[model samples]
Target: MAKSRFRSTTEHTMDSKGRLNFPSRFREVLNQYDSEILMVAPWGKNHLRAFPLPEWEILEDRLMTEGREKPDLANFIRYVVGGVAECSLDKQGRVQLPVQLRTKVSLAKNIMLVGMIRHVEIWDKEIWQQDNEATSENFDSFNEQLSQMGIF
Candidate 1:
């Protein structure tokens, strides 16, 4: 499988009113495509997830693959469905995060946008700092363990 070329990362701040000024580089990535996008507050995390419309469709398809008889899948879909919102960039190249998402991520002043292969994760500054620290501390050991699995 081909790896996605959309990986990018940026740190930014959200204003007191919960509006974020997305980085220009990140905006450039979005501009390369013509499509609406969906931003969602993923479960069990204090962050927002942004997915291009096409990518979101793929995710939805994957979710649907879970058997209808599975209660966990149903519950997962309910939470994900309610947390997702369609968004678009304004002239200033900013997207207004929904109030719930902003609150979910505790996004007030400092924010970080971390690009994964197919999506972006929005995190609060303090939380990102702590998470980064934890990841850094365990990265070497994590990689070693993964290597043992022959999956690294």
Candidate 2:
């Protein structure tokens, strides 16, 4: 049986057509959602987040309802929710990433698909390397915070 959540990271290459061979392990997680559609959107400064259709709807609904009163949150919704691209995997397990979306994050030849629990993150290979290194640098502080929260 497939696992309930997405985890781990996998390297991938985008074809000239901008299609990526979606990882098989992540596809197993998608099966649990019973949906072929993925809502891909810009995340943070340098990555894209892909959510299953159902999950995307849930998030969209929340953004619509909760972002009404908060200016900062509304801005966030504008960036993340407004740029979503609906995508589906082809028979060969490749998904066609929109040119605009790909360009936004500078995704070119090499990329990384990162399992982010409920969603998956797509990052440029070089950017991910730099970001991962920066995160690793602060691991001790993060670990201490997690421990303080009773998570470690």
Candidate 3:
């Protein structure tokens, strides 16, 4: 497994043609995995997430395994896997966000690419701010859960 963790946020603009410049470092990680293919999927109605093909496969495996006996997981897995678009970047370090996905997440021309360890999350600036507004207030509550999980 690659030990490097993606840990930065960058703001970028989408060209008129609908292509956005992917960060060089992020692209390099995809290359290291031997694939540039990304499984783009919407989470909820506000944001979209991306996982390089190999990384996505690992997540798929875990979801599927848990889904075998858990109907809820199966249904969610169905939704996630069903609503994905396989994407690849062009030579210019730009990727065309599929219209369907763009609409799903309300992706505007100006957005932020956030690194979430294993995957990438593309967020509409307004939504990102909205979603995080309560994070600071809820940190202790959230931290308690993380501690229970042995994550902190």
Candidate No. with top TM-score: 2
RMSD of each: 2.8, 1.7, 1.9
- Candidate 2: which stretches are off by over 4 Å? 1-3
Judged by lDDT against the true structure, how good is candidate 1?
Answer: 0.72
lDDT of 2: 0.90
lDDT of 1 by residue, 1-152 (tens): 34333566687867665556666666666655556454555654677788877778888877777646576777678777677888876777677787877876677677888888677888888898898899899787788778899979
Worst 10 residues of 1 by lDDT: 35-44
Q: Could you say which candidate leads in lDDT?
A: 2
Instruction: Give the alpha carbon lDDT tens digit for every residue of 1-152 in model 3.
Output: 74565669898888767688889989987787788898888877888888988888998888768668777676677667888889898998877888888888888888888999888898888888777777767778887788899998
lDDT of 2 by residue, 106-152 (tens): 99899999999999999999999999999999888788789999999
Candidate 3: C-alpha RMSD to true structure equals 1.9
Ranking by lDDT: 2, 3, 1
